[model samples]
Target: MAVLHPRVAPRRSTTRATTWWGKAWVRAVEEAAFSESDLVTARTLARGGHVGQITTRPGGFFASVEDQHGLWTVDGAIPELDETGTETVVEAVAAEAGRIAALLGGDLPHDLVEHTDEAGVELLPFGSELAATCTCEAWAEPCVHALAVLQQLAWLIEADPMVLLQLRGLAREDLLGRLHARRESPVSDDERDLDAAVEAALYAARLLDDPLS
Candidate 1:
């Protein structure tokens, strides 16, 4: 079973909320909660970058984000496979997500800018078919609303890394296909015999433990 960490609530602030971005973030969160397929997508897109398209109008900013089956946050960071070499995928995605969070929090290192196609830009995969892009334009990298969405995503990611993988175009089916192909490949007779023997031994062991044995 997976253990979930308890979330620490944010400290309340009493200062007058007058910043334009701040207000926009608040509105974005509220609208996202009602409109998003899930909390993850709502939060990530709310953080604000280029994960999708953002259209600004006289009324306000309208964002059109790709929906990855409604999963969000760090969960979006998880890949679908758990085979060897897949850890690299998870780490890369996490590193990217972390960079985005750091930029948003004003803690990003200057040297890291080169990794991104554009300076201070962060792109996060939402799922196998979707992603969220964050451009560090404001003092708050993603702004407050975007940060709020990210906070939620972090929690989800910590819980399950698969969400990130699916966002990066690698799904469970992809992993299984790779595994099946590897197993079916031609091999020496000795190697094949050894493999068969191992399977037979495992089956015999299971039979021994069975109540019907």
Candidate 2:
């Protein structure tokens, strides 16, 4: 599990998610929300520092949020991929050297997601696929508190797409382990060389970007 401190308020902006995957997360919850007013209020709560520390783990996240009523606990979950689904996603990632390189470099490859989706493993949640329950007595399936937590979650996702992968059931280490095992399986020397080259390129790019590091 990882803990995320409350976000410092940012300058006014209409955009909540800057990354493609982060935007997809927000869209999922927005489509599930029944009340537009709640969404508006939730956005305000999320941006104004009404939300407290958030805790995340495989398949779920929770946080404390304050509204007009009071402070409330919000727990949200996106269903984890089953064992078969996990393997399918892993296989998809392992098959593409670029996907592994991108992930190692803290980037999510769009084509990797497309491949997984084509393989029937929806890496990103959709609609009510993301569900939440709040301690607030609100009748809405996802009260303002829950929505606020989710909106904050999108901010975290923007910084690290791996958050989505973990929420979907595969942690970073576990995913990498599976990929390593697949690579260790019977394969041609050329394939190994290609994987090594991709990793070398990623490392070189990082050094060039921040020589001080």
Candidate 3:
């Protein structure tokens, strides 16, 4: 579990996502409209630094937020990738060594999320794919508190792309482990060895006297 506090609490006028991926998350929230008023309240709560500790789980995440009534707890869910989907994730990660290296270094490339399509997986939420529940008595499908949590979660993913995949049901450690395994697979090793031998042969051939010439 990790915790994120708003570096600068949001303001009513702060109406944009800091990262492109973060913008996508904000768009998803906008798609599920209840009342614009509720949205305003949510963003206000976010910018005011009223949100609390956020904890991650297998298929979702949770956090608390303070509203006029009291402190409210919220639960967020993201659809998990299945076994076949997991295979796609592994294949994509294996295809790009730099992706894993960046993740290992705690940086996620801005384009990393785009590779999910090649893997036939969806790391980011689609339309109403992100769902939220709150203990607060706001009857909107996604109450104000829920939106606050989503906003914070988006910021979390911007800092670490691993969090996005984790919501898709792939743990960071497990995903990295699988990527490493594929990178070290026998096929890749054989290819590397063959390339090395070819390069060596060429280098040696070049050194020979120009008898053929």
Candidate 4:
């Protein structure tokens, strides 16, 4: 799997999301907020171009961030979907072949976003499900540095929607392989054969544990 190296441009005064998926992802991170101060700090840090050495894994994203608050002591992590959750995601994708094609093409189709929501498949974190954690001194999350890293993530996904899938729980190739299996034998019924769907997705989901995948 290729590691997505985002061209974190400088002078990001504020976060922007033009695409539906990008908007949803940014909204989720903002929604997990405790105060506006965090957002402001994150924006400031991002503009100053302090976040760096960013890396993504199946389970989450991690990076080295810097700011006045922490000198040579900055790190953050954004966890993604879990194994059990991946099965549901696979099943949902199985029922929607067009969605797979769109993802394979690097487009996060609006219809697929709706389907994922309808099926309760969290390709990104929502509300209190999780928040970006950091090694900074801040007691709250989406801490300035962490938020900066997340903001960069927004840019990354905007460029390539498949990165969202990578964050969720599977690498593009592995997820594609599983999806190919689904195409060969479409899921008969999501509810009745949920077990089978999960089983089919198990191998790919397990690989999600691989760091920097």
Please list the C-alpha lDDT of all candidates, in the order they appear: 0.34, 0.79, 0.70, 0.66
Clashes of each: 26, 0, 1, 0
Tens-place lDDT per residue, model 4, 1-213, is 547485475773556777887887778768876777777777677667787856776656777787665643334344566676676776666665455555655677776667667866656667565456677667776666777777777778887777777776677767656655654544455433433544544544557766455
Better of 1 and 4 by TM-score: 4
- Clashes in model 2: which pairs? none
Best by lDDT: 2
lDDT of 3: 0.70
| Leading candidate by TM-score | 2
Looking at model 4, report the run of 10 residues with the lowest lDDT sum.
Answer: 191-200
Candidate 2, residue 208: how far the Cα is off, in Å: 21
lDDT, model 4, position 56:
73
Cα lDDT tens digits, model 1, 1-213, are 122323423323332224332333244334434234344444444343323332221111223233334422222122223333354432332333243233223332333423432422332322222212333232422333343444343333333333223333444334233323334543666435434443443455468679586
Name the lDDT value of residue 27 in candidate 4: 85
lDDT of 3 by residue, 1-213 (tens): 343434446555675677677787788877765778878887788778788877876688888898778998898888889999887876665555465656644565655656766656776677588788899777886888988777777777777767777787787667755644443434665445433433443444456646464
Per-residue alpha-carbon lDDT of model 2 for 1-213, expressed as tens digits? Answer: 554545546436663787788888899879978789989988988888788888878888888888777889988888999999999988877776667776766678898899889988899889778789999898988888898888888887777787788888897767766665665544776458546745565566569789987
